[model samples]
Target: MNPSTFTVMEGEDNERIDQRLARDMDVSRTAIQQWITSGDVQVNGKEIKSNYKCRTGDIIEVVPPPEASPLTAQPEAIPLDIRYEDDDVLVVNKERGMVVHPAAGHASGTLVNALLHHTDALSDVNGALRPGIVHRLDKDTSGLIVVAKTNDAHEHLAKQLQTRSLTRLYIALVHGNVSHDEGTIEAPIGRDQQQRQKMAVTNVNAKEAVTHFSVLERFSEHTLVRCRLETGRTHQIRVHMTYIGHSLVADPKYGRSRSSPLAGQALHAETLAFIHPRQQEKRTLTASLPADMQALLDNLRSG
Candidate 1:
């Protein structure tokens, strides 16, 4: 097993060892505790319990166990809109209403299943659930996503995401007329404790998220806008827009009561740019707004 090391900083002082490790390593606290029980975690060259309070300037080492066998997900013959492809990566213009990968309730007919059928190999860095998936678009949001063909490619793409070098832009039709031409939303996002399925701007275990947007067009009750993500967070644009009193036109999770002509959120990932892992070159790809979104704009223009 490849052992990892970390040093507890002053900001992390007094935190439980397991919690500190979980936050720093982006792993589960339960998993860290398990490693502690197995004597695979040490602080200053001595094994410690999970509940031990960490002090600043402490050196920590973790030797994680070997990963379990990869889970098997059957490949399906679902159609994919391939935008670009090469040996190390593939860019797909995913359609709206298509789940990006498999989950407990959605175990089939996902983009992963389709990709498995289309390609013979995929990076397993994200484990079985999301092989080759460097990032994701919501099921209702359509647009470009890049898939990694090998582990090295996956790591490179993931580093771009972490460094905020990966560029993602979206086009959305939101409820209400936006007054400003452009603005930025800077908020921390975390899961809602009351409603586990929802995310909110909360301080508790929240991560910093920033979204910049510009108004493209205005209508009587809606506005078309372009958004660029500075820091990717789940449902960030949707949540931020809603927080600013301009939820998406048809976002069932965050929109007003009036049903929309479109079935889901009128949001599309319009552009994606990233540095290629193998080629060491920058690549930017774009996808046009889906037919439904375009039709909605046309209707607004005609009226």
Candidate 2:
């Protein structure tokens, strides 16, 4: 997979050196810059800077790197509700009450553990504890999640998420009916200074966060809503919903009315969409709400 060499004639060049090389070689500008930095790209058969202008009669040598497998794939006997799996990625339906990864208070039986058991290869970008975790659902949230199997896959998926190219949608039953049929929560989210355990919309040490939601079903005192995330932040959905005066039903920490029947928050990650890391095509994955949450909603609707 090494890049091929090219001869630049005096009167045929008409673009920036990097752009020209990228177009001529069918590569990316970033890749061309990388070659220049590594001294593998040269003008007139000699090493040149990335910004070097091309002249007529210049011989350009491009040494493309060898294509190697991104990581080692291993198979382990871990139980998983696999929604999708390919050479570069996987999708899993995470059950309600399942932690994404192991933490101090909890270890083993986590989604990571299952992944390790199910597949041997996962991107090391997030370290050993988290192999392929690009985005995360809360410990109590159940839904579909995409996982990367290699470094290239990890980088590609991470970039999509950072650029807001990915779509994450959730369904939740809140304590009260919303006043509006649809609304957007354009609020910044940051760590709570007073309480480290909570996230809040504040000006200090914050990042931009936005949530768009529409009502799905309305109960006498509860509302089921579908929320889409435009920006990812820690505890984003929970925090934004609480800030807007309708905390998720059964969320003990944020509930205002306090007449709770469920043991945990009634939230579910219903759908996720992103570009395929290897195929470069868009893909969407979905999952049904866990039985407990579904039953809770049913009971709410009936009562």
Candidate 3:
């Protein structure tokens, strides 16, 4: 097994080794705890427990566990709004409420389940549970997503994502009027320690994340903004906007309680652009605002 090494920085002193490593590695704490239990994590070349306190000069080594067997995802008869499709890849306009892939409580009715039924083959780089899924959108945020049909295509798209060459643009209605016409949020993002279910702008074991946004329109109590992602961390846009005191309209997790016609956040993945893996050409796909988001905008305008 290949091992990764890190030095505990002065700022990380007294932090639990597992927690520090998980934050620095951008992985789950649970995964790091398992590694500690299995003797896969060492401090100064000695196996350490999960709660081992770190010193400023400590050297840590981590050997990741082997991949588990792939989960079998069953096909479901879920309808899809396919925007573009080719032998190499498929671009889909996912609805706001649809989960991208299955997980604990969401075992079916996901985009993966729909794709399985619609296509005979999908790139297995992400395993069976998320076959062909190159990226993801939150369940309450609707937008365009690309799926790979083959391993080569998956590798190409994934590489584009890593290089920040793929363009991901989103449209959101935020809860407050944005004063700046355009701005960028550059912050480190990590899972919230207090609220484990949420992502937060944190420096602890966090990754660099950037979101660029411009105001599209202004309302009395809200602003419509266009956000372009330079890094695609989970909930990057949402967290960044909230950090600036402009959470999305109707956002349950980050926004203040208010009355709204919408059931979820007013966020949408409106555009996706990437170099085609097979055709060797640039491809850009867009999805219009879904009915619910559009309706919210109309309501705001009419008031």
Candidate 4:
């Protein structure tokens, strides 16, 4: 790309050159500063510091460097618990604390990193960082998640999820005793207005969320439940359970616990059923509760 020229409009006068260029060119101020340091940005045909204030009618030229790729998702030698794998799909019992894909601040030790190490045949429909990820399991919640080996498989599995044909079942330990044996929670979930890190049941920019739960066991103060999801919203089960006054045990964001032995929410993806993308056959897979959650239950029963 050629150098872009800009004239400092009246309102932008006296603004920092880096800020002005970033706003005008719709690039990051960090990139603008990099251009300034590299002598790619000029004011009135002379290179100037990023802090230089712009004046009205000042001519600025910017030659942006080639767009740098963000951090690459590296393939790590992390072992994956493969539940099922074939030509078109792979299903893995994602363990607790394993992130499903690479993202900001969670670049490594993710399932994607391990998947990359295991196979390079991941579908790129979700882009490089999230290759083959048809859906995601929350970092703290462990369980079965499907990955696509090809773009066609990716689209097929994604359509199943959208149409609610991809069935996902979870085992959740909640804070309070659930009175009913089985019930359905249908609520709208959205990002919490006050708490940026939390999702809440609200109508503001929310999506329809549904969770069907049946009591599996009951303890003195907690209840173990089996939950099936009909919609895959972010934090759907966690938010819906909390909305029904049965927040997951040890859920850092939703539960009231300040300290607990568990690493994260007492929830796990126990079962997953989806049609095989290539074979067109129904596939159902399941995994038992993780050790930590199991230990918690044992202690509760013993007490």
Count of clashes, each model = 0, 4, 1, 0
In terms of lDDT, model 4 sits at 0.86
Off by over 4 Å in 3: 1-71
- What value does the lDDT take at residue 62 in candidate 3? 85
| Candidate 1 lDDT tens digits, 1-303 | 468898878887898887787787777765676567445688897667666998999999988767511234678998999999999999999998888876535668899999999998899876565789888888899899999999999999999999999999999999899999999999898767687567788886578999999999999988999999998888999999998999998898888888568889999999999999999999999999999989999999999
Q: What tens digits encode model 4's per-residue C-alpha lDDT throughout 165-190?
A: 99999999998889999999999887
Which pairs of residues have clashing backbones in candidate 1?
Answer: none
Candidates in order have lDDT scores of 0.86, 0.79, 0.86, 0.86
Q: What is the lDDT of candidate 2?
A: 0.79
Highest TM-score against the true fold, candidate? 3
Q: What is the per-residue lDDT of model 2 for residues 108-227, given as tens digits with 9 covering 90 to 100?
A: 668888898887889976655568988888887788889999989999999999899999999989877799999999999866769856778998667889999999999998899999
lDDT of 3 by residue, 155-215 (tens): 9999999999999999999987899999999998876879856889997657899999999
Candidate RMSDs in order = 8.4, 13.4, 8.3, 10.9
Model 4, residue 250: C-alpha shift (Å): 1.0
